[model samples]
Target: MKQWWIIICMILSPCLKADNLFIEAESFDKKGGWVLDNQSMGQMGSPYLLAHGMGVPVENASTLLQVREAGEYRVWVRTRDWVKQWDKPGSPGRFEVLLNGKALRTTFGTEKAVWHWQDGGTVLLKVGENSLELHDLTGFEGRCDAVFLTSSLDLLPPDGGNELADFRRKMSGLPAEPEEAGEYDLVVVGGGMAGCCAALSAARLGCKVALIQNRPVLGGNNSSEVRVGLSGLIASQPYPNLGNLLDEFGVVGHWNDWEAKQDPSSARSKQIREILQRHPEKKIHNAGPATNYEDEKKQSLLQGQENLSLFLNMQVYDLRKEGDRITFVIGKSIISGKEYIFRGRLFADCTGDGEVGFLAGADYRVGRESKDETGEPRAPLKADRLVMGTSVQWYAEDAPDRSGFPDCPWAIRFTEETCVPATRGDWDWEAGLDRDQITEIEYIRDHALRAVYGNWAFLKNQSSKKEQFAGKKLAWVAYIGGKRESRRLLGDIVLREQDLLENISYEDATFTTTWGVDLHYPKPIAGMDEEPFLSYCDVQEIKPYAVPYRCLYSRNVGNLFMAGRNISVTHVALGTVRVMRTGGMMGEVVGMAASLCKKFDTYPRGIYEMYLPALQTLMRQGVGKPGFPDADKLD
Candidate 1:
């Protein structure tokens, strides 16, 4: 984190309005130990710096501030005490803003449960250049959004809404309009398995494509940050070649080279056998090590595409629609605060959250539908805001030496009765089921963090079997929450449980969904009172079924396409198709459709209405080779 090279040149412009100097924490030159967390950028305004040291306080995050006036500047730091909602004991996310090595009079992230500006009294500074450091007090999840230094005594920052947005824009000196990011035939607004495949598939079919991901990496849930292995059987019939590109994508050369080899003596078969035999520890679902996901390989795979332009660390927040069809989408960099515009003929919302579709005024649904409406056996009696929870997966490994963890009275405590009786967390360790998955994501993630730390603290400090956990230390606890269900974008047909159970096939059947109808709910724990941290998965066994192409394209939005968990589906149907592998197949189909649209100058609906045969031909024979354009094409 040697940040001296990142010179803080703010307050240098003469056209600036006020003497107030505002700096987004993510813009720091050298972040040192702190990580950029923009998951809650929609809820909160800007991305902030998070001190995710687990229990141990990380190294200092230093930055050089160019102070113009250098007088008595009243400092205000935007932050929140994440665990304060439960009204727990300790302030785990406490930190201080240091100016010129002198700690501020006020410690931030100690009070407000919601995001607010915490006044750090006054600090005297020298004119030219000054040192700014975010001093972390607890290794827990401390956060700082932006550091505000103003000569004004009475003016305070807006909590949120349009006022705060305009205030930050004018003060931070960001452009009023977003920077243009070139036109494309297709713009996929996510970097998940579905989005990657959609972008790759379209690009391979000779369409100019743009793949935009909010995070620093390409893969969303399967990235090393989230550490979820690919699920659902790939390369299934009616179109066995729908996932050929995905088959060639794996961490090591072993699985990446696999192509339905049956010969035991062949090198490819032997290599596949060896790698799977070696990496038995990596689970197929969640809570695996970082190396298993292969973020680098996925990044390289997308970047290697000839017609695909991949942009990481970019989040699409808004869109421009002429009538019902989307013309352009706007995204901003999560780290540098730079905004870019993506003008495209067709748009795809693979953002598990349906961000692009939502921006386009497309119809979408959240939570379960009433059984009366959907006629599904497992549907809730009433349509409510009870969606599936998100998982904050974690794991522990044997430490080199025995060490004791700190007491976490502020965290969710576990008695001997409520102790999970486990050293690691998996898909079951979920949170934020009842809350809004889109708006209150930060709250959802923070609650899971407390559960993880709290459960571990009990096992290590208070449980009768504490001796067993004495040698174990938390290796990884994913801060990037692996979400299960959220917004389900509505299409011409909303695939329901009956469709999968009855094996009803559509004329435009596309990808095969093999996973069972898996739905998750809050598990009832014995002693815990609040929303349960554990999840109870109620799964209904079902044979392989093909999903119609109607579910892939939007019903009203003319040019919009969708893939991933966000595709048109009932809450019940989402269980089977939401998995990464199945979503990848959806991307493959969407990408192929995007290519046909580019080739014919037709919309997403045109392919289903008139050009269905062409799409079927492309599906029968995929775009061929990972980055090879038109290797196996109908054009």
Candidate 2:
């Protein structure tokens, strides 16, 4: 019995050691530890150097040292420069290194381009490793990977010293800040499909552009965070280019690869191809779930060849103008509590909420306009009567061996007396979730998704349907609501249902939207007592509608441009034009117009009278067909 007790004590001794091993890497930067020395770089504030590298790096090119724990450690790295000299043609690049407050006498060689830390040379680190950092002044360079060490067993080599050094050089001399006094040539607000194109267009045309985006991710609703598939028409007989350049950036392979396996006649495949052909250099921006834009400098197109910069995490607090010509925009960062003063020659209010135009003394309206306002029979007799309420759509994932029957908040409401007999919720009034009021949509969607999870769990553990969903898992919950419609900024041209149904085309038309006036019922019970949910539409056949250039610019503000569902449209008509594909087209047109504004040094309105030809040419190159010089198409 005593021997058995000794054996048990011996087994537990390893679990109860004197001290467990841990490691921690440190540096002075935005991260707490070692701060960088940028006095030689003319930095007024303590700006820590951010790293850059060519090719996709495992961590951020900005990430120098990744520490897992705290303990005595040995850290070693090999680096190289791009300079191929007579002495060593491919030697390690020039690099700066600091280990434990001591600079190492390490000259980089190019021969070790593929080197990892364990290959002969490694850095030594002490317990509670205080500081270890390398500055790659450049943004992103070629072959810069790092390996940190707390123990000899955990050592690995570093690669691409010259590439890292090049990154450092680029980071050393920062671009001069925008002239604090003068107004910018063009100011684009929003970073969705449209806003991104608009800023790129204006910048390409040599206009100083300041793109203001509120969302952390640039692609807006189509982003992974938003989790919606990209929608647009491809350039062919029926499809025109919709502003889908950003979506193309995130595409891994051809859409046909997936579509061919599912449906060969899928038109969505062709549309995706057209978008990819136009913008091949699309870059993906993943903001994760519920990400907040921290620094505009880090995320925006701040490094434009001309003077286009993005300000993220910054909210446009107010708008100030001089009579008709807009003057300045005041914004503040929610994180830093810093203020930004943007003075632009022309302003574009691309805020989906039309916040900029609404604040800039521009006239706007919410809901449907009456027949008197826009002589359309479909228009409600009462002006501003019925607006498209916002929708909150959500999705649920099935679990593996699904046995988690979580309870739904609205489960009590789902009594057999109230609901129709159905297994899963669908687009019907029967067992489908109910969302009557705009204010209640969020609550309804939340509860609906919750109910889905709960139902799955009940089937797995409690319900008789356990055999069906034995192994299912609930994947995720959408934190942000899929907001449908909001305030529309009054533009130079008010689009009506007639423009869509009629064969009318302006010489300065930018893109065409083909979706019909599709509207949903107010509530499940409002229009349906004996039936389920129903969608109504006046037009049965699908026909393309022309969206003119005038619709993109504000009626009142000089520089303000508009896009997405907030563009000028009658309530009934907005039902059609507010589709995501139409939004992409609007964005592309906005981008092209912004470029034209920069090229011709003209206001957005001026493009209608002056640079119409240039705008047409841009469309021809981008979307495959310019809307102008073909008035017969309208006939």
Tell me model 1's lDDT, rounded to 2 decimals.
0.83
TM-score of 2: 0.57
The regions of model 1 sitting more than 4 angstroms off are 1-18, 252-271, 281-285, 624-635
Q: Candidate 1, residue 227: CA error in Å? A: 1.1
lDDT by residue for model 2 over 166-204, one digit each (tens)? 222222222223224346877777666556656665666
Looking at candidate 2, the ten consecutive residues that score lowest on lDDT are 37-46
- TM-score (C-alpha, index-matched) for candidate 1: 0.93
TM-score of each model, in listed order: 0.93, 0.57
In lDDT terms, which candidate is top? 1
Error of 2 at 129 (Å): 20
Model 2 has an lDDT value of: 0.48
lDDT of 1 by residue, 460-494 (tens): 89899999999998888888899988899999999
Clashes of 2: 78
Cα error, residue 279 of model 2, in Å, equals: 21
